[model samples]
Target: MSGSLRHGSGPRSLSEIARSGGPTGSGSFVYDEATLRSLISKWVALADHYDGSMRRINLGAVEPPGLDFASEALSKSANTSGTAYLKYLEQNYRYCVEQAQLLQDTLDDYLGVEHQNVTELNKTDQPTGSQSGI
Candidate 1:
């Protein structure tokens, strides 16, 4: 049989390669415990900056320092091939932190929209009986 006619022994398509969960591909990149810890720490710090009382008083001053520290640590640790993994971890960690912030912002916007809708509904001069019926 021709090579292309093979059942499972032939090379995979791009989509198959992309979707595969084996080694020698993106699947090989696993998030280690240290990376998870760094990600969680960054996310908590970001949430604190956005919602903590001290952050509110300071107007978001705390987040930059934490981000800067993370950047510096990543740069310092990215020297050897073993430590080179830190660079990827750092990038992923920052991306996760940013995603968390975006999610929080989206939720806040949704809540504001809902609150406004409720306020508008309440402010209408409709009959209490009709409104209560709904």
Candidate 2:
């Protein structure tokens, strides 16, 4: 069971790895609270950056530079490609934010379980009246 993802004979690309939730071979993921929090922060930051970039890319503000048929065709193609690229960026941003939210939720659940376990243990640790070490 190789942890690394492969495409045919070659390793998977970064985008693939990202889409697949990283290179966890066995599908078992483990992370500390700090690591999870950090990952959430980074993902949020990336999403914010992408959100900013999407705002800055105002395709409607600029018109095609030429009026000829050939130029029009070229401009149309360029706009189409640009729109697609923008969509890709938007998807990436959404993915990042979603990943961040997942991590945060997982962290919260983990902490809740941990606290419950601790509370249970603490209850057991307290000596009952019948078991008082008099």
Candidate 3:
């Protein structure tokens, strides 16, 4: 994908758009498909890394140094903190994966429209033979 694909920017020709092979926009912002895909890949990678890291962590395996009340309190606090931290990581992973999926869907749609436009243009540009068979 290339830059300069806009929704209501002043004016654009089909050839210019076809040459760019860029994004589809709604009103103001337009994203380049290639750039978008790269970002999406990063997001997915980040999410997967986070998920794998979280899976490797075993907060429950941690034990207190002593069997005293203070140790028990510390253990409970650690568990609470660990659970909260894991929750945060889970949310972050979900957000990253979700954003990647959304961007991927948008790119797919843009590609579909671009393909259709090219197909239509080719149909119109084709040379039709005359009925006279000359």
Candidate 4:
């Protein structure tokens, strides 16, 4: 087939390669129980920073560091791109957490875009050459 994604029996594109999964790819995360436990424990205890930031924001003692100086009305009105890191982190709470579930979710999200790109490329210039592998 002119635009065939599968070349013989092997992964024919980056999308396929990623979907295949491996030790570092997706499902095949090969960490020992102790390592995974240590990581998860560290991840679970990550909220101390949140406590500090909340205290700072609550006190209104100072604008949380790195946030550009602007009045609330102006900052709100502008709808600026590139807000402070803390603010961005606060907004994306789900992504901020370190967990195995997020890995596949994130990969699937980007894989859609990659698949689209591969489709577009195939449409423009479908390879005639046969690829070889198992």
Which regions in candidate 4 have their CA more than 4 angstroms from the true location? 1-29, 59-86, 98-134
Instruction: Give the per-residue Cα lDDT of candidate 2 at 25.
Output: 64
> CA shift at 72, candidate 2, in angstroms?
0.7
lDDT per residue, candidate 4, 1-134, as tens digits?
77776536654533344455523323444343354334433432343244345446522223333456565545454334324545654544333243422332334433453212222222364335442100
- Give the Cα error of residue 56 in candidate 4, in Å: 2.9
Error of 2 at 26 (Å): 9.0
Q: Candidate 4 deviates by what RMSD? A: 18.4
Give the poorly placed runs of model 2, Cα more than 4 Å off.
1-29, 60-62, 113-134
Candidate 2 TM-score to native: 0.59
- Candidate 1 C-alpha lDDT tens digits along 1-134: 56665556522532232234323523444433354334434564443333333223322112222457776565445444434444445565456445544333333343343312222322353344421100
| Candidate 1 ranges beyond 4 A from true positions | 1-79, 113-134
TM-score of each: 0.26, 0.59, 0.60, 0.32
Worst 10 residues of 2 by lDDT: 114-123
Q: On a 0 to 100 scale, what is the lDDT of residue 20 in model 1?
A: 42
* Model 1 CA lDDT for position 77: 51
The local lDDT score (0 to 100) that residue 32 gets in candidate 3 is 77
lDDT of 1: 0.39
